[model samples]
Target: MPRANEPGRTVSSRLWDLLFAFDPNNTELTLADLVRRTGMPHATARRLTLELVEAGALERTSDNRFAIGLPLWRLGTLAPRAETLRRAAQPFVEDLYTALRQHVQLAVLQGDQAVIIERLSAVNAVGLTSQIGGQLPLHCSGVGKVLLSHSTPAFIDDVLAGRLRRFTPRTIVDPAELRGQLASCRSTGTVVVKEELSEGAESVATRIVDGRGKVVAALSVVVAAGSIKLQAAVPSLVASGLGLSRSLGWRPGIPIRTS
Candidate 1:
């Protein structure tokens, strides 16, 4: 296999390597940080970094670190999956946030993880590290479970057979138990998670289907554990999910398709 800095690597690939080094956790980085993260030589890293800054793909912070620029974010908004789903689910997500005064999020499956596309959060709600672009574990998170349940059987099997990380003691790591949970999730179109992903956090999630009844995304409401009655939020959460699904052309009697 070729190394990242091998002579065969293209310039565009090197540039992308630098950009990809910045993520939800490492959102800002210094030139040295980029060099180490991308495994590029200091001079080459600096040159590409400067070029990206000139091209408005990255911006320098007051502390002399680099972060993704506005133009780059604007370009990401053009992606059909994130923008279309976010726009269609905005109103319903807002209503849920207002009613529950908790964290309301919309997420879609991306590979083995669930990526949060949009989120509305309350000031006093549970302190969560994940943001709009952050990812959640498929085997533990409420939205993750909903999306995973509606995924293809082969894909679901791969996830269940893989190493499931135990975030909390309550996290269901056993494949047999999780299989049961996914079965229930598919039958009911929703799942309730209690402190599986994070201690003192609980969530309830429902699938968001499209016109063809393909589960396109998952909508979830997360609250501090024991802060509010989870059951009370279920009706509103499912209703908002259905309302968003309807906006996407889904209707009654359409058989849900596994993606």
Candidate 2:
């Protein structure tokens, strides 16, 4: 039997189920799909869906399909860790992107995923597979590895115990190999991923720290595979990460550590 907190457990949970059903891959749905996805009665789903639409958490498209609303996006912008850190890092990220003429991204750990908070892309740079609000796996992408390296041991173990989807041939699906990669990231304070998330892309990522010297975010620059050497990009990425960290009040002589 399912627990009380399981799917469709309560009205609130059903509402959340309705909301989270929208994702990057499946961003729009009809009311019938919502009922099927949430396992709620049609009338109940209609009521809660309408309530959410009224609350501006979801929107009705011109085709009468529903999707995540602008208000929800605004609410997500209010997340202190994401919004505040993005605001603090924007200028530095912009400068770095301008200098490198590549895709620069800022991301933070949200549960078991790395969520992109902000991104700046060059028109001539490699077409990226990531979106501003998209989530990436912790075992493959550069930003994901940086965030995972800074995460708690328990969280690491939990992720390792779960399914690690292989997005590409280079994606690290084995727990042991991923552990070694995480160790490397901890030792070097940076992560470099090549063709892991996408076949023709490479990412160089570094950690961002707060005044307390704790890792709070990850900064990454993605380029077309083999176009730029990873070693050449590392110094600039590390410097930008430190600059943003300093902007957040992180200073010299403090014991810097990942979260």
TM-score of each: 0.94, 0.89
lDDT of 1 by residue, 54-113 (tens): 999999999999999999999999999899889889899999988999899999999999
On lDDT, the leading prediction is: 1
What value of lDDT does candidate 2 attain over all alpha carbons? 0.87
Per-residue lDDT tens digits for candidate 2, residues 1-259, read: 3332355487777788889778778899999988887777788889999999999999999999999999999998898987888889989998898778788999999888999999999888888767888888888889999999988898899999999998899888999999999999987779889899998899999988888978898999888898755666788889999999999998977776755
Predicted structure 1: lDDT? 0.94
Best by TM-score: 1
Q: For each candidate in turn, give its C-alpha RMSD to the true structure in angstroms.
A: 1.7, 2.6
RMSD of 2: 2.6
